[model samples]
Target: MSLTWRISLKSDEAEGPEDYFSSSLGIIFPDDITNQHGDAEHSLIYTSPHLSKSLLIDLADPVKEDDRKLFSHYLWNASLLLAEFVESDSLGVPLDNPRAAQESLSFDVKGLDTLELGAGTALPSIMGGLLGARRVVVTDYPAEPVLKTLRTNVVRNLQPAISPAGSSTTPADSVLVEGHSWGELEDSFSTTHRHSFDRIIVADCLWMPWQHANLHRSIAFFLREAADARCWVVAGFHTGREKMRSFYDADALREVGLEIEHVWERDCNGVERPWDTEREDDVTERKRWLVVAALKWIQIP
Candidate 1:
């Protein structure tokens, strides 16, 4: 049977302004193997116009398999956005680019201790390592399948210099894959890595409202207690604005001693705008917008 159904990424008519989905950072999806059968995984190459190199990722067929395991196996749009943000060299607004407002923040991963919480395919962490971060630790739920795939992707993408835990012979080696379950401060990872990272990357990990407090705990734990340190988060509104909003609530963040330095909603076309709380329920429309934010640990007297 031939596939003829149309897959539309947006609605017939957007209630507000025109859709900005097309203004995405150059994330080119080049191939998908049709000859493969069963549950075999396929490779995806993610490239950006700003990046000198492309990322090779192996996502499980259909991606739903990872969904079953807490969405820890598939490549998400938020991940791509986070990666784009990390890869961007936009120091300040440029008059030459029309989408200049899209990149309102600068997040250079170079020479920094980076950590990614719930890194499924670990795209952002891999990008950080490739872009010359001082150290990049890719972590996820301590599950065998999840950790295995994460390690494979890290090695495949950041090969030659990639070092496994306890095997590093030099400082030149960057990427490290590990198992980390959020809020498990009693665990070895939590104890040893506390106040360890300069930057923490979280993409599309806010869908689970119940895990918000625990997620904050992890962020407060690993994030360095410095003024310049940041936890860069990019979460899609596809899961609904309320669910995403709960995670970034100011009071809630204050409870964990983490404060939002900057937060905004960005359209697919690279336009940065304020969040709209009164918007109607439209998952597709919501998907067209991403909440990008930077949070820092609040110093207490």
Candidate 2:
């Protein structure tokens, strides 16, 4: 009759003085629906505890009123998946469900300097901080309110790591949260980090087919900042598989000067499986495809 959820936090085994840092929000679904698509944009909802008592977020666009509620539901489920990773210890974390595919990925959060684009709730960046990345910068579209919420959530969730006393023992790694759009990336990152990111992580950022060019441009600028920079871009889409063919084609990536070195299947347990071209019809129709693409900046030695 009632929905119940729980949140957990786990420790990491990386280079930081602290062993790990993580948290989870649990949800117990009521026995009402049986056949449901496990999509984050269709299953999760989050409420703010402020006296005003407003919904914390609605990830979908407000213009599409009918779809607004559906997106909220999906965000609620995604929050749960993100909480799980925050609480886990492993570097390559598997997502609990397909809805979580967007937030679930391991990055060198502790020692390596990194940047995360379209951070949504900033879960991936938080995980990076816990993993011991020397510095982790999270950015989203400048016009979106999601960026602010992400900053708030990061501070709230990572309070222990930011404390003055904790800083002495664990050494607080920089977790910079900011508003950044593809249009301003070159200027923004250049001024702040000054060409100093070792790794770049992007998740679920492609979908607006129109923005593909801008996205590619932004990625190129960042990768060019460092000759050895490595980028991992994960995109999750449920609408239609054929729509992505143009975007995922090898030539498109090559045009941006990025060479796809590996294409791996990511299991729920977070292990990378060898590439398999087989397609599942049922899954193709219902769930979005989760793609893990690794790219290295092709700089001639």
Q: Largest TM-score belongs to which candidate?
A: 1
Clashes of each: 2, 33
Q: Model 1, 1-301: lDDT tens per residue?
A: 1010111122343333323332122233212111111122335566544344555676533345544557654566677666656655422213222334434456777678999999988877876776667888888877777787888878777743432222221133556788887888888767888898999999888988888999999999899888788898988777787776678888999988989887777755565677665566464466567778889878831
- Candidate number with greatest lDDT: 1
Report every candidate's CA lDDT.
Answer: 0.66, 0.47
Q: Runs in model 1 with CA error above 4 Å?
A: 1-40, 49-53, 60-67, 90-104, 160-173
Candidate 1 local accuracy as lDDT?
0.66
User: What does each candidate score in C-alpha RMSD?
Assistant: 9.5, 10.9
**lDDT per residue, candidate 2, 1-301, as tens digits?**
1111231112122224231211111123221211111232321233211112212222323334443322322232223333344334224333333323333334333467767776665555555564456676777765444554566656655444332222211124577777766746557454655446777767666556666666666666665355557677665435434544454556776777766665554432343344444454354322323456667655532
Model 2 vs. true fold: TM = 0.61
TM-scores of all candidate predictions against the true structure: 0.76, 0.61
